[model samples]
Target: MSFQDWEITFEERTEELVEDYGDSWRLKFDDNIEPDNPAQDWFQYIRGAFARFQCSKCKKTWPSRRVLVVFHFRLDGRKRKGTVEARRFRQECRRCQEAKMEEPQFDSDNIEVLLEKLVERIRMRCYRETLDGIQRDFRPVGRSEGPHESSHCEACLKGVCRKAE
Candidate 1:
């Protein structure tokens, strides 16, 4: 059979693999679930994503309302020590705007600690389902990967994050 007959969908591809291997394909092969295009991994990550959120006071959950949170962390790649800063924008909460002390607050002297918290919030805020459940390793692109053209995104290095400061 010509390859053209195989539909370009995941289910179709999986079926094609199974037919060729007598259902042992799954055991013999690792999952090729990543996006067909490699560039999609990084490009999509730089773009915004979302996740489920539950309101404490209303006792309800909703996925409609969302926020854009821009973030970066600065630290030595080898030592892995640095502070992370994030810009989170959300319209003032109806309940929070009305009451001054309705919400709790805390502070931290250690930047690393705060950065960890920010990263965690981003994970919860960004819906994994929306991003295809793939996490980019953020390693430096090799010569074979793509053009080494000069650009703002050239290096995903630690100091690069500090530039946002």
Candidate 2:
């Protein structure tokens, strides 16, 4: 919801997607209706970003670049169409005793990087295409020092993140 103010405009995302999936590719904000299950053709991947978080109770703000977001996508080769679903992860305020899992906030730069990596994954997984360069890591342009706080991460708490694994 808060990501509506993303610095990366929709046009930029569309252009990036069009370059890979062609002009018929569509980006939809998934409502997550049915389930997390992906069909046979659907490919699932994880995208991480440096997300900012503000505690509602304590009003404490912090930056974390390891926020894990899940994505499900598929490309219909015959139709030359594609669909993507993004699910943002949340984190709790470590300082607040009754803290709720707050949605992570991302900047334009992070969004741009995330989308680029996502499209790359789509190209490889769905289209079975190989890239010339080495595979890139999800390193967003931001600074968040110290070890990752698994205690505050919703994915870690739910045993879904790599740390939890």
Candidate 3:
């Protein structure tokens, strides 16, 4: 399938999976199954995730309209690893970007920090086909995955910022 179509499907699957599972696998199914000769599905799947950005200056939120990318590298003590990034996302308010460039120290306007959070959200959203593929082809037991439960801190939910600053 084409990559764009893959993203929508991936997003749906990730949302569905996360509702039940609470997180994506650190290494996706195909990543684990065929590590030595890994399939390119991980790249295909991650390309579909979306990260939205909210302008701290104007408080306007927009879909970053950026595709997430996975970077692979080797560490001295570890096997090959991957991390996601939205490095090219620059669609935010021009004024904000200009302000960031001039100051570069405002916590709220830090592009890297924004991109990091965006990447985190994108990563949380990219595991549908992987899990579905495995379950469809290889679930030996019929047992349910688990209960679907939602948890939240009541204070946080009520918009009360409780942290000491």
Candidate 4:
């Protein structure tokens, strides 16, 4: 028969073999096996997989039991000052006492890297928005004399102050 016909026959035979063997024989199925109901979308699967956890203290529901860990890194070239710290906190429910513990799988280094990546993404977006706003408001006014310089904007300054408090 044709290649397509042979392939279909082989698939049917494999299913039959699996059924005949039952639990006694362990067959390693190929990863490419299609789901029975292929019409199910990814969103439906994700929604089903994502279980909600209720906080015992406040009775508030969370998407999952995982807690968010925030890492702060500061560097001041002029003063030669640099520091890195990690803080773990859970989104508080109606009542504040119940806090979910973060997954133990994430090590300090992993958390730090995640924070670094997040900061990079935020910085990129902030710079893009600032450039757009500047282009809209003021003319080039001729390029500056030295290398490019950057300073903490008001939002970043406020965030730093809040964290310190």
- Top-lDDT structure, candidate number: 2
Report residue 90 deviation for candidate 3 (angstroms): 4.9
Every model's Cα RMSD, please?
20.7, 3.7, 19.5, 25.0
lDDT for 51 (candidate 3): 35
Candidate 2 lDDT, tens digit per residue, 1-165?
A: 344544234346557557755645555565352234666778787756677888999998888877877778877777877777777778998888989998887766667667767766876886677867455454443567767888888777667776433
Cα-based TM-score, every candidate: 0.24, 0.74, 0.25, 0.23
> What lDDT does model 2 reach?
0.69
lDDT of 1 by residue, 1-165 (tens): 111221122133334324532331111111221222222212111212222233455533322112223444322324422222333222222333242111111112212232333334333343122223333321211122322212211122111221222
Candidate 4 local lDDT, 42-137, one digit each (tens):
100000011133455656544422223333333333453323233333232334553543222232333333433433432333222222222111
Q: Is candidate 3 or candidate 4 better by TM-score?
A: 3
**What's the ranking of the predictions by lDDT, best on top?**
2, 3, 4, 1
TM-score of 4: 0.23
Prediction-by-prediction clash tally: 3, 1, 0, 0
lDDT of 2 at 24: 52
Where is model 3 more than 4 Å wrong at Cα?
Answer: 1-48, 75-90, 94-165
Worst 10 residues of 3 by lDDT: 100-109
lDDT of 4 at 84: 27
Candidates in order have lDDT scores of 0.26, 0.69, 0.29, 0.29
Return the TM-score for candidate 2, rounded to 2 decimals: 0.74
As for lDDT, the candidate ahead, 2 or 3, is 2
